[model samples]
Target: MTQRHIIRRVRGVDTSDGAGVKLKRVIGQPALDTLDPFLLLDEFRSDEAGDYIEGFPEHPHRGFETVTYMLAGRMRHKDNHGNTGDLGPGSVQWMTAGRGILHSEMPRQEEGLMWGFQLWVNLPAADKMTAPRYQDIDPSAIPVVHPATGVTARVIAGELAGVEGAVRGVATAPVYLDLSLEPHAAFDVPLPEGHAGFAYVFDGASAQVAGQELARGDLGAFSRIGDTVSLRAGDAATRLLIVAARPLDEPVARYGPFVMNTPEQIHEAIADFRAGKF
Candidate 1:
């Protein structure tokens, strides 16, 4: 099997979103506009309550999917579709904004370390206007597997070995994993051919992947020439998020919080939201 290598590395930029909640924008930055099927990747981490207390007020989304994984802290979310849930440490919320939806996510704690990530996955044109849905997964529902010595993987979506993750029936079959590796530990992941893949190192000094070492906050994109991903930790422990998915390979039109195939569709979404359609 061919081994995937890093073809590009992007250092995240510090940005604020959702009423001044500080975060690091990795994929949506100018350096790397996007990876096919993956539109945005944001990491929110802070111990100061002032940084995230405002949280994400009511917002509208359409024509895409959003995945939120929490590493620490607690968040409460509610949508206009009569859905409410709480996400704690190790919890994951996968929401499909098919057609349109209005939602809000707010911090549930007064003060503490809050760390998490939110990823945006694009939907094919055919499924863009389907139906809004959600997969609110608790921490205990996720499967933890040991792929190698000193390697721990929490599978949120997709399969590791023969164990399946909690999320299924997604448009773009995706594999999302939160991995922690001890110093010098190594692991090999099998990916479907032609799928887009990337690794984001969040904790630790560095991690070796695809013949290159990625420092903290670095997002490395894998080459499409391979179907296997090789990961090795450096001298210190490392924690990272690795994800892969089938590419949509279609035209993408994006606005503030809406994604569609054409500019006209985006305008229509805005008009609908203003008319209280979402």
Candidate 2:
């Protein structure tokens, strides 16, 4: 019999990023700490314009990658590398801040709900100073798979049921999927051995691999022992995002927007940013 994964921890969303934005931080917290190559996961959702209108101002980042997936609303991104794009609903933006980069993400709409997720993935020591790059994906480019009668999965960065996702070549070997299930539907997904994985419920209710229940805005982090994940929808329709990645197993030294392997590197990054070297 195959081993079934269990939830090792659960977390609720919290306020972060800047003023006017409410986010639920799943990783990078004291309870969960760092998930190896995966550093942070934040879900930003709000109906009030004031809650997100201010937007993320020009900021600097180094030694990591940022993955932004929009569920609703639109976000316009402008970076110092002459990269510009708009992330509409269901779109994905994967940006690699290998060495360093300055960018801003602002809401394009004046009102209505603005909901999305931003995940921070750490880079290994060897690639920390590599060139910056990006993958801006349209909603249509993402492949949707119907694994079962009432199950729909939007593959973003991994293969599922013989269908490979569009966002590939990530060093972390990540699996990012947006799943929707109708009432009483069950689905089983395979995970690579030794990978760290978690699920975030954004709509309705869900029963996780270990029979643990998760409602909207809740995050279920899985144990590393299992190779398969199971999920079941509640009486109502449900939607969730599942992420998994290979562990880097390296030391983490984080300083605000920068993440490095050593304290000296963190200090160097700070000094370089102040001197406009990034």
TM-score of each: 0.99, 0.96
lDDT scores in order: 0.94, 0.86
Winning candidate number (lDDT): 1
| Model 2: colliding residue pairs | 13-24, 14-24, 20-51
Instruction: List, residue by residue over 1-278, the lDDT tens digit for candidate 2.
Output: 25556556667547667645777878877777777778888888898988899899889999999999999999999988898999999999999999999999999999998988899998888899999999999999999999987899999998998999979888889999999999888888777877888888887775554577887777777777778788888788899888998889898999999999999999999999999988
Clashes of each: 0, 3
Model 1 misplacement above 4 A: none
The weakest ten consecutive residues by lDDT in model 2 span 1-10
Task: Tell me the deviation in Å of residue 200 in model 2.
Answer: 1.1
Candidate maximizing TM-score:
1
Q: What are the per-residue Cα lDDT tens digits for candidate 1 across 20-76?
A: 999999999999999999999999999999999999999999999999999999999
What TM-score does candidate 2 get on C-alpha atoms?
A: 0.96
